[model samples]
Target: METFKIEGNVPLKGEITPQGAKNEALQILCAVLLTPEVVTINNIPDIIDVNKLISLLKNLGVKVTKIAKGSYTFQADAINMEYLESEAFKKEGSSLRGSIMIVGPLLARFGKGYIPKPGGDKIGRRRLDTHFEGLINLGAKFRYNKEDHFYGVESPRLKGATMLLDEASVTGTANIVMAAVLAEGKSAIYNAACEPYLQQLCKMLNRMGAKITGIGSNLLEIEGVTALNGCEHTILPDMIEIGSWIGLAAMTRSEITIKNVSWENLGVIPGTFRKLGITLEQKGDDIYIPAHTDGYEIQNYIDGSILTISDAPWPGFTPDLLSIVLVVATQARGSVLIHQKMFESRLFFVDKLIDMGAKIILCDPHRAVVIGHDFKSQLKATTMSSPDIRAGISLLIAALSAKGTSTIQNIEQIYRGYENIEERLKSLGAKIVSE
Candidate 1:
């Protein structure tokens, strides 16, 4: 039971580097199972969820060697297929959502993949139908055992086929792509998730001798190759962490430089914060946020309607950053509506913001309206419990900009995504201690 004790009213100033993307790391790590050769990965973030996945891989007999601080080499030359049916696997695989991705590569290579019911943040109903159905469409047999709460996919051999996903599900697309990369023929995926995470995975696979085209679009073509070789991959910056830093600077009136951010891949995140009237300077691959001046203001629509900040698929705002946007809006000069379309319960965190002396209206399970205080009324720090990874970071931002010291409990939820968050923020002059 660790908590973060934060002293507010301090402007964080310094250059901080964003770690590798968590979502991408999950997919990339699972892709290692597709080949028996050594796969060297750079810029791996040392976080809880990812480490858990690494442990799961080791349990299945993958040899993972530490190359450096944030680099590792994984070789799956001696995998134990029988371990997938063991109780240890059920206990390990069910802990994180990323474990479900292993099923695709294993099922494609070994003809059988089993996973316990995966667990993750309680943001909303994250369904596994997308992954299972996609694999089934690729000629794999699927089954669900309600008594044991497990999912199984088996196929002696997979044949590629055209399939349209119900939605552009990220992990679902990754699973199907991994399976399709080694199937008998070409596979066309329509309405697929074209987020940078999936694109990087595809690019990495292509580097490892898999045939995949349409890197940055909804329509993807994967021609099944006989075998894939191991290759090195360097992950892009964590976009969610970049957004969090932007919100943190605006909330605390800090002048912080986020170094080496993948500018082109961020996709509307920097511009979205700029719409809130925050000053953003993009120099080369870095983003520099200047200290606050007359506070922040929300830009109105062209037709003079109340401004609304919402999340959509890629090339649109990400749902993961909506919580940070909502927290940032509370300190802006004008009002804006934050709509989280993908996840329902993510908006529930606004209640904690409202209790901190901010004006907020909870419209529904997925929407909230925030009237910016614009620093006229500084938020008073109070004790609160973090509900999820994004909300935890958002609350940490609020606590940093608050009037007094604040405490956030259940920090393990925060550590699941952000690596050494308190230590990193403290380096930027933030007064945060974990205990």
Candidate 2:
């Protein structure tokens, strides 16, 4: 229920380091249930989702110990799978979408798993049909009751099979991969999600004795193994945070350098920003954002038309970042269409931007065309609540670039991913305070 009060138009100038990815950390923590040996994970972000997953693991009797800051040692030697049926388990499991991932590991090791309806952003109908379908293809039996909203899975001995996912759901692909690695035969997953998080999960699995081919591509061929041992792994830096920082620097005309960015993992994101005329300089592993660069016109087709930026599954611009990109486009000198293909309701927040004096046309549930009015430093101060993690950060960027003071409520949403964000930005000279 905390709020962020910001005084706008203050240029940020300093260095910022992104924390480990939240999506990746969730998967890595779930993988701990796959083995009884001790495993150490470094660079884990301290976030709400991670804390919830840790709580779930401790409830299952996994020996989780924090060795140092941003590092933990986990021993699942005494995992009590019976806790999956408790009311406390159901409540915490249904609190976040990532909790569903525990089902795969639990079923793989203990032959049974129980989960309630999962919760997450209310952007749209995020179906678990693909997850259920993929797990079923891997020889897991699923039963659910709609009235009670409870779901259960059981597999005496999982037999691997070919799976063609209906949609490339990122977490679905990861859940299936985790289950498939321990099945009886070879499993091939076509149309899989190859995002950086999944890639890190696959790499960690391979290091733990799982034979997985196609590390960064959609077609994954996983050879089933009888058992997996523990291994130490370090998570990759968060790319969404990197993208948000890039957008933040551009909007505030601030000179900032993002340190230790995984330059190779940023697929198609840098080029996509270039289309909006933002140039980023990469010095080794760092990205430098120059100060006060004139916003350029958005590029169009050869025939001179308005460009449209849309989201796709993987190797495309992430749907999570479209909000930030749309907010950044408001200060550009041209018109562009922002299409959020994955989520139907994510574009609804643009009404807040429209209230701030930007010219935007909401074409439909999934599309909005933003025409830049060159309205530099003209946004009126307003009170708004944080809708989601990415959208909250996008609003913060908009607020920092506006003319007057803006108060954003529910800052815990932003803290779900970014670490010490207010202090980091404050070090960079941004006028942001939490009240």
lDDT of 1 by residue, 366-418 (tens): 88999999899999999999999999999999999999999999999999999
Per-residue lDDT of model 2, residues 152-201, tens digit only: 88998889899799999889998899999999999999999999999999
Alpha-carbon RMSD, candidate 2: 1.1
Query: What are the lDDT figures for the candidates, one per model?
Result: 0.94, 0.89
Q: What range of 10 consecutive residues in model 2 has the weakest lDDT sum?
A: 372-381
Clashing pairs in 2: none
**TM-score of every prediction relative to native:** 0.99, 0.98
lDDT of 2: 0.89
Backbone clashes (count) for model 1: 1
Candidate 1: give the clashing pairs.
Answer: 296-333
